[model samples]
Target: MIGGIVGIDQDIVKADVTPQVDTANTDISTNYIATSNDYGKIGGENGSDWTIDSNGVLRIQSGTWNDESVAKFWSSLKSDDGSNINAGNKITSVIFEGNIITGNSLASLFDSLENLKSVTVALGAKFDTSKTEDFQNMFSNDSSLESIDMHMFNWENVTSSLSMFYQTGLKSVDMTNINAPKLSDASSMFYNCKSLKSAKFDGTNFSKDGVKLPQFLASCSDLADVSLQNSFTGKITDTSLMFDGDINLEDLDVSSMNLSSDTKTSFMFQTSNNVQDIRRKSITLPADPNITNSKIDEYNTDRYKGWSSNLSGDIVPSLETYYSNNANVGKTTWTLVEKDKSQYKVNYIDQDGNLIETKNESGIIGNPINTTKILGYSDPKNSESQPDLMSIADNNDQEFNIVLKKLAPYKVKIDVEYGDGHPSESFSVDIPYGLTSSSAQVDQSILDKLASNDSLDLDKSKAFIQRIASGNPATEGDGFSLSTVISGFNIDGSDFKSIFNGTIDFVNEQVDSAILEGASGQTFDAFEIYFDKYEQSESHNNGGSTVSKEITDINQKSATFGDKETKLYNSNGVLIPNIQLAKNSDWKNDKQMILDGTKYYRVSTDAWVKASDVYVYTDNISKIRVHADNRSRIIRPNGDLSDRALEKSTEWKTDRYTTINGEKYYRVSTEGFVKASEVSEYK
Candidate 1:
């Protein structure tokens, strides 16, 4: 050793060593340490250990090594046996080229580098599939790792259970030959790795042949878009659920797939092709072409044209074209085409080969015609000019113009002709000037008042008058009283009484002189006159009772009875006092006698006796006579009998006999007799 004293110049170092023990030039190994020379080489049997700074980049010396030198050196050196470097050491970058690094056994050689930033296995290098576990573990702990290029090796027989690839900050992954098949459970394989923007899959190699598609893109919330390159032939039982969880994906295209309408809920499309065929065929249009005409008439009119045209072509042109031509001339033609009664199809065709429109035979002949003829005009030849009749001679023609008067309108008689000569009889309807009473009134004030007030109250007023006067009682001298006439007739009964009594007095004075002595002239019998007077008094009393009871019942039932005492009929069927009850309370007794027509009375009977008189028994025997005329007699203490007569009694006689002062007294009467008299002093 020529004095291993190293001379150091500023930043340059030079070292020289002489081989003491040299066996062969290839087997000779040298170790040298140089400081800052920028150029050095060591020939060795074993690979040299190169130590770089903490942040230094180690690369193969390119310019100094020729192809022959690299070949000779690398061939002789043991190929990168990393036994010198410990496992789990830090590494910055790893790159390999040529045959230096061969199999994944090299991965084990670098497995100790936990802080590896990048790993690029060169082409033609073999990756040991069994060491996938080792490399996976290495990558899992290595957070500084940025990229991995395993494209060189076909990673067959590699069972990679590493989900760490997704967790890593891997910008790109080259899994070109991954051979594992059961990847159905690998959900979110690339979840949240926003750095990964582009990816591609070869359909042949990376196809989801039996694998479900949802497993591939599940939980990919950021995956807002998707595209399919080819037709999807797989059976997607529920395509709706495929995108059910992808809320961000607003649109999808299943146009490439053969989707069935049966499974689709809402298939909105431009045509009916997307809908089931049966539904599209069910739509139909109505048979009648003209909307203005009734459907029945359109059918019948077509039939009439067909029938008339079939008689002769000259009489009626082709039935189909007749209406079209006539419609231009403002005329409509009815067609009646012949048909086989059983078959509804119109068999006849026009010269133009159009089917002749036909009406249904059942509908045409079976329809019952309903027509009404209104009275058009009325002719009055001549009428006398009276206060009530129109004058015909007043006009120059001496004929009354009996045209239907607008003032008193009358409707025409209408008759309906049903089939088979059956004609409905004509009837007349009174033509009302207006719809209702309110409309008929010309005055706006009256119409307004009528509308504002209830019509029922006015109807009640008319009914009130009719209810009080309706019966034989009003004519039978038993009429309404002062109170009832005031309430029911809605007038002052005292004023009515004054007017009526004055008329009666005037009539009586006129008849009084004529009736005084006449058997020849209009004579009045005193008894008949007296009976009429009595009946008038009785009727007045009874009519008042009926009206009072009706008003009372109405007032009691209604809480809203006004102060003006509204007159009402007895609708509740309350009995009027002094009116006789029906013989049977059941109201079905026809044999019951009619009192005042609407009432019945119970019948009564009485017994009659004759009195006997004696003259020898001196108990002041008095003789009295009773007449068959209705009268009564009573004996007085002065020995005189007072006589009272019944107005219209039919029969009467003595009721008893008495004896006084040794003389028998006879009780006799034109009416019934009462004989309890004192004896006279002369007797």
Candidate 2:
């Protein structure tokens, strides 16, 4: 081929040279590493050589490579080309400086270097998703790698999908010096680093305007402590699983943390609301300024503390003494107070020199015992006046009864006291018994004497007799009058006088009237006198007969006139006056006129001895009788005399007639012969 194998040899030589050239061209075209600068050009001009020094700095020698250039170079190095530099070799260390490696290609570089121990990227090197598959798995299998300081780069919008520190053997981490000005979207940048012990978030580059991520340093059980800057405004919604298995985080300070609505189920301790300081062993309660012994007892009881007598020993000195002294007091403060007029409140204190409770017992002070009057009478002791005693009993159910005897009128005092030191006071009621005539003041000395005595057993019977003996005398001529006494005693005087006078006078009058009216031969005229006198005098002058003998004399004269009848006859004895036939004669018509044997009356005057006078025998006439035997018997016998006689007898027989000679007779009837019509015309 020296110009196509020199002409004649030229033709054959030319053909050989063309095939050789074509073969070389095909090799060049297919080998990307050979053509790429990704591998070293046959001279030492391209490709990257990574080296590590004893000082742990990773040195990388490259020619004009940025992150894209280094990534392309590493891609060639990991390819299967014969000219590739680090293919299938264990890289013990890598020192890279001033390189811009990024994207999934850069991660592929580290993945091929299985034995890589140390890698050092340049100070301004930024590895991104395109240069590597998130670069997170770049150091994933590199357990020998110990440290990483990626602070120099501006990781501002760099999405850290890589958790390069997780698989590496890192014992400690320091995030204090990191200035993540644009790292707002980094949620869990170091979520599961178990070897991490300490972390710091004291920078001002953090934004407070969004929902914060939880467990940013979560499962690092060795991470017992953390510090947060005051300028942090991240919201924590779910911190529950953040420390789920952390046992050493007892005193966590969450005071500066703000929570969102989703942050609710965080607390795990009992009495969570009562916990104040998270660093202390016990919590302080609200200050109870007035703690009483009773309150303490109640608290103790509620807490199930056993009862002890010493519980109240710490009470206020005053209250303690009151409790110890007054055994009747109850367990509450209000019970210690006495509800009465005095209104005294007891001051209670506890052992801590603080006032606990107060009790008021002043209500009962100065209250007097109530007294009531009981009506009663004492036994009579004297004849003159009775010693009636009135007593008073205190109405207080707690006190005893006291008897107060009468000392005088209109004033009564009870002598009693409440208790030992209380003196007996003199109290009097306005109204008193027995002395109505005059207002009299009770003798204090007498009451004092009576009160001082233990018993009230006086001889009231003897006293009464002595009082009567010493009574004021009645005035002269002021004889005891039943009417006056009865009026004073408010009794009916007439009834009293009637009771005082015996019934003997009335009985005697009744007996005498009965005897005169029912006697066998007594004249009715005599009975009239007695009955009239008795009736008129029964109630007057105590039944003394006010009518005297003159009345009796007139009665006797009337009786005699009624018993006798006188008839006037003509001198011729020619029946001039016939008592029965003189019905028209004025003289004969007198009520005193009667027909009798002493007064003659003729039936006819035709022919007869012209008798000068006629008279009926009256000397044989009996006293005027109310009943008679017959009309012509000259003395009353059983009546069968004659029709005329019977008729005359029937006329004389009445309730007003008297009996004479066993015949009925009126006051006008005479004890004389019968009429001539009865003697002659009937025969």
Candidate 3:
């Protein structure tokens, strides 16, 4: 009776159950919220340190506002039962007045402050979550907490995290400075986080040592532009209905995933189907031939009986720029060609179009290129669970097509894998039907010209193939018929010792996404573009057969944690705790970072002021509240505490700074003084 479609012609009905109000309700107020001790902090040793004024502003009068429970500050007139008053819940805001929270898991300490709407951690305070794990129910069902700035909290070793933020009203979360190497169970961790708008989880957040992640962010329906590959790099054995209800996830990349142990993935993507494109052809089995995972077949049968997996291994490389930049998407290629008599080398180009050296081709060559070395080989099928990278043909069409498969959003990716173990025969191009080309260049140039013309007429495409097949004339007098020229390949694969394969990626509007057709009337995402760079199949011997050593390569960003240093390098790039190393003598020269713009640098690695000793003045005013109740005192210009004590109402004005015995002090006025650690810095 509570949920259904609210049609345009329907008038919505509501239940009018009114709640009772108190006769003497002070809730209707123009005053602010102050120290209520609403959380039963009364009769304690430091009891009178905090108090609220008539204007409702809760202010800390003295002492560190340190506490184990933040909710103790909340209370309303209705819950003040003879000093049993509740704290934090009734108060909409609180002033820290300067308190250093040395407690753990401040995420959970605010568990009782469900009504707390805003909190500001003043300077000189630090919150640590270095060893916290169970943030479950930490902010569970806290509907009133709209924002919690966690930029300053440290989360170094958080582990078990079940329902950490179940049903909270957070609009955004700051997951900065987090390190959860031992994280295991995170089921429903952000379950149904309906209001979570954006997230900033980096690669380290999902490293190894964590357990399987299932239903972790299951129903985070409002999330978009998320990279599942970026947020979770741990094992995922059971992904059953993991994202069954996420209705707004736009793109997902699960490429090169290790599903060797994944036995059950039923309904994992049942309802998360409204996507633009899947990133990669997810591996069912790995590339290894020795191992086979049988569970994948059962999962496929049980999970995809009705719904389609939109995941695939077939690719369509774009040839639209075949005449221009030779921009191919899959694994990139490096070839070697000859400019007339000069053997000009062909450099490899990355996916980003940057020219990279041939494998082991740069720097000093320790040894000569070994022709006896068998670099690598390729096959139609590598593993039972993995996709067939060479499944490009549709019902055995002999002639290579100009047209591509019409899978929108998903373009073809040719995986230009590095390292050898591939047969060059697995990657050869078919000579056009009528062309008897002794020259690989003439044969390839003709093909590239036709492929670049997207709207090439079908009959003309057929004629070109037939002309090359039966030996139609481009003219025999042409000079392309040499014994061997450039072999069509721009860069030779043997130099880099690379392999070739294909993958699936989104239709990149940034590079090329043009679709073309072949002589068989079938269309594809790409035509045989890069293959034309190779010589006619009779040049170089690949696998005992005369095939050019044409190849491709794509740079894969290695997933392993590459950085081992965890020390925080501050503005000056100086490593703290190594302060003694900064002792400069007449022998050591000091380096200076250019004082341009707003750059920060460390003058001496050994120099640093204590946090308690540092304070900044605002608008020419550096005043502090008098919290010394009965022990108020004055100090002389000579930096000595006066024998005569001052009244409690006197305010101290800070003027300048000085270091006495390595301890910093600020002059509140001409002769006034207060230890920096004893009073809060006024903003």
For this target, which candidate reaches the highest TM-score against the unseen true structure? 3
What local distance difference test score does each model get? 0.26, 0.29, 0.34
Model 1 lDDT on a 0 to 1 scale:
0.26
Determine which window of 10 residues in candidate 3 has minimal summed lDDT.
499-508
Per-residue lDDT for 458-503 in model 3, tens only? 2211111121222222313322211111132222221111111110
The residue-level lDDT of candidate 3 at 440 comes to 19
Compose the digit string of candidate 1's lDDT tens values, residues 1-683. Answer: 11211222221111122112211332211332211122233112232223223442222211112111221121122224533322134346544322331222212233324456655433432222332322222344344554554444333333222223333344444343343342222223333333332232212122233222222332223333444323333322222223222323223333333233222212111111212211111111111112121111122232233224222355342333443344322222233333211212112223344433332211122222111111211111111112124321212222211122112332212222222333323333232221111111122221121122211121112111211122111223333333443454343222222222232233223333212111111111110000001111012235455321101000000011111221211222233344332221111111111122232211111110100110111122222323222233444222345564323222223223333321223333311224322111110
User: Lowest-lDDT window of 10 residues in candidate 2?
Assistant: 525-534
Off by more than 4 A, model 3: 1-99, 102-108, 112-119, 144-150, 173-177, 228-230, 235-241, 255-267, 272-683
Count clashing residue pairs in model 3: 67
Relative to the true structure, candidate 2 reaches a TM of: 0.27
